[model samples]
Target chain A: MDDVTETDLQAYVDGQLPEARRADVEAYLAARPEETSRLAAYRTQRDALRELHADVLAEPPPARLVHAAEGIRGAMRARLARWGLAAGWIVLGLAVGATAGWQLHAWNSPVARAAPGIARQAAVAHATYTPEVRHPVEVGADQEAHLVAWLSKRLGGSVRAPRLAGFPLVGGRLLPGESGPVAQFMYQNESGRRLTLYVRNEPGSGAETAFRYAREGKIGVFYWIDRSFGYALSGELEREELYAVASQVYRQLNP
Target chain B: MHAAEFVALIPRLRRYARALVGDRASADDLVQDTLERAWARFHLWQRGTDLRAWLFTVMHNVNANRARALRVHSEFDEDAPEAQFRPAENGLLELRDLERALADLPVEQREVLLLVALEDMSYTEAAATLGIPIGTVMSRLSRGRERLRVLMHGPQAAVRLKRVK
Candidate 1:
């Protein structure tokens, strides 16, 4: 047909033309051998390009990409969990209000408020230092004895770097915290994933609590206060892995 | 939409990026940037819409911005398409030639071609992803395919003779 346009022919090659017009383009190409060959060439080029990069699809995606994807899932879950916590607090507050209105203030205790701060600080610290290639830590693991001693002195409390099974201590650093100096011990696994232990001297922070999780972007923090010192273990590792590492840190520190 | 759905598109994204960038590491970096931005702006994306197209749109913007920034610092002339796609010295392989030809295309043309040819995107989807009109997409596709053909196989004078009729 005289109406068969170049776009239609191109669409034909791409299989993008609507089914109703396909036969028309085929008939148009039947008379024009050159157009047929050109379309054929275009098809071949498409196939060659696909074939060339086909291996990329087969190759497993890099870990960082997966982590980034998982980060979105984690971030969303964290947001939902945060909303759930707030909803839970509201429900508890309402029940408490019905029983004794004056007790509502207790729910907003200083310790509950302080936990998030520690997790946020730890997450910020982890995000800041984990990406360093040449200098991930201030005091290298070789000087673990001095590193711990220096951190313990600056933090105004005795602190020991936890020996994680897969993650060897890369070193430790002292950072400015809301209350005072905070000690951050860095650890790196065989695959170059880094985790940090953030310890702050928070006296009168109340009784020890199990690991509480907080996520900031890609970084996840599992933090708690034990014996008046706030401890937050931060990493990009999954919750279970970080939890297991935090449990190890707790055992080693208390032992 | 769920992040799992986004994650599932990674393989296709990687394939498209690898073809688009012509280098594995840079391609992965592009995908990474794309995913990060998409994740950050996930709220803006409407549910039940084509997530793949939306992700590609994010990638297209990211890539265009990067390319613009790079052009400012680049020493070579981007318009010198002929100089860029010169055949390799050793004449190694046909696939390499195709790669070079694809790379040498103007970024706009290359994008349309890859979206249509490699990614199997419809003209409308490619247009939407690149934020161009569908007519522009078709024109770019036509020009890109012709240029690619010329680059891959020297000027087709014989084919042109039939067109003169």
Candidate 2:
């Protein structure tokens, strides 16, 4: 056996040495009386130290320790509750922000959301036909009741040919709109200046709107939206003239 | 870890605590502090490691912090090892001398020596628990074992031996 170092001998007492080293330590201890006595003394120290306080392990743990352990679980549960509440608030905040975004976008974008296509068609149709010499009216004022009835049936809402104090009904025609067909009714006065009112339903999902005006070159247009349908008046005239005509359209449609 | 696991660790903690502080009540206080700390920092403990060693390390640290904060190193205080001297029910003189010698060890040596000699922890485990190097554990163990031997049987121990013999 190699000379057993103190560490190896201690390892034997600690039961930490591998078997080969431990056997060597055992043989080494068997031969040396002085080292053997030292080993025995160390063993006694270990035993008395253990015997001195070994009973402590069998004693029941104090109540404070038990309560402290329970406190850990309770604190974790409270933290989880706090985290759950925080997550709930985050979700609610996202929902509110989304709804607010929708409401703001709804309230602020009427000019952008207005049925520009319908109004443009009105302007284009007026521009297309105001210069024509004939065929300006497809079904003339003689078929006015039939015109209103057929147009209303197609548009899914009332199509009123608005009254202008100077301009009487010239004629009415059906034009294609974004969702379905549109109705354009023409009126003319002594100087032959004409105005067209375009009406359609099923344009877009929107709430009520107010009278807003736009101009396509010299042609003035006044447009507004209600719960279900949209109306636009197009004519080469003063803004006041078209406003008056659109107000008349609005009042009659609502009435 | 479950409550049962923590419960299982309690006795060992108390034993180590009593070994370090050498008093039952103070040792229980140390165990309570260790448990409270372990509960708070349980997540920081990695699984698949020695939980007992981890708990011992926590108790060692808690005891150290309390000692430093209170500046109270009740090194062999009167009530502790002296209490073991009341002529044992069988008057085991040798055992009484051994207990007194153990309590007389320096705090650092007792911490390392008891962890190894009594708790039967490996040197590496004792080193890790006391946040010292393994070589340091060995040196402290050697010094502590030698001090305990001299105190138990040196010329100064003649009186104890005569009483026992």
Candidate 3:
């Protein structure tokens, strides 16, 4: 009786001890009132728990969760089809490679060429517009609200003109492009350097693509598409400087 | 298992899952996830091994993962009051209190306890289902039961001990 450990009492409560040992523990509990109380407490807790959760067995599970799981099973067959005879890891590797290849091809395109595209576009826009004192923009920054509404309407989805934090708004204009109507919002720093954000409805069938960087002439353009709407930030600034401005644009636009 | 076969096990899976998670909604999610995983990996289940044990193991692993995610996101902090602890609904010796108390236990202890008390799994079987040692299973169940006993009666020890005259 004095030799019994707390674990032994717990084992007895759990019904894990052999019958003889269990009987011995029971007898020991009978003689020790405190131990008996603990057993009673354990039994009550077990019974209470059973009462609480027993109905969960009868309750209907949510259809949505079950459906999602079913959907996964359905997709498994199709996934295996595209995987060919490759092992899971090999297939995963191939998938990663394919994604990288597609990304490289897309990123290197004119809309997303390395270093030249955006820079060239930015330089073109800056050079063409900055010298114009009377016609810097088709629409001035004074009509900011109307500019956003008009641009958003033309873009076929809601578009917010990005507010560049480190720079002040110069003016915005509507320009004809190979893509649909493009809205260009220009911002200037205290140093008189200009940045242009070009947004339009993606050309042709429209592509849902991620961020791509390109250099157009002396300008650098960082472009991305969300749904059918396309966004491009073009500037003659250095890569990091251009990116810093673009980051501000992205935050404001996304927010 | 095929789609039909997987669907058929849904009820039994839910029962075992409710017993494991101690929450109806989460248990249902766990069972659904389990069946999906099972269907995808059915071929990997060695033909000679116990299907019930294998299913239980998969469900156990999935629940463990969900528990880890819950810890990380802690998204349901608003429901934390009800998540790990909720009082029994009415006056009875039903399983609700047990379920709530079960939720309060750590993942390992709760799994062993449920496998033993509700699933009627032997220590060896529970161990195999958990991929743990039999001794570990014994220790967990022992500790879990002791903790459950304390939580169950700590508040109502006096009323529970009173006999009807």
Please report how far candidate 1 places residue B2 from its true position, in Å: 2.2
Clashes of each: 0, 0, 30
Candidate 3: stretches off by over 4 Å: A1-16, A59-255, B1-8, B69-99, B155-165
lDDT of 3 at B20: 67
Leading candidate by TM-score:
1
lDDT for each of the candidates?
0.78, 0.71, 0.63
Each prediction's fraction of true contacts recovered: 0.51, 0.45, 0.26
Mind giving the per-residue lDDT tens digits that candidate 2 earns over B7-75? 677888888788778778898888888877776666566657888888888888887888789987656
Please name the candidate that would achieve the greatest DockQ relative to the true structure: 1
- Candidate 3 is scored at a TM of 0.46
What is the per-residue lDDT of model 1 for residues A136-249, given as tens digits with 9 covering 90 to 100?
Answer: 889999999999899888987788987999999999899999989999999989999899999998777455543457889888888766777989999998987886788788
Ranked by DockQ from best down, the candidates are 1, 2, 3
Error of 1 at B139 (Å): 0.2
Please provide, for model 2 over A115-220, each residue's C-alpha lDDT reduced to its tens digit, 9 standing for 90 to 100: 3556676788779877766888778998889988888887887677767778899878888876778888888889988888877784563544435556799998
Native-to-model Cα distance after best TM-score fit, residue A12 in candidate 1, in Å? 0.6
RMSD of each: 17.2, 30.3, 19.7
- DockQ of candidate model 3: 0.13
Better of 1 and 2 by lDDT: 1
Instruction: Give each prediction's DockQ, rounded to 2 decimals.
Output: 0.21, 0.17, 0.13
The better-scoring model by TM-score among 1 and 3 is 1
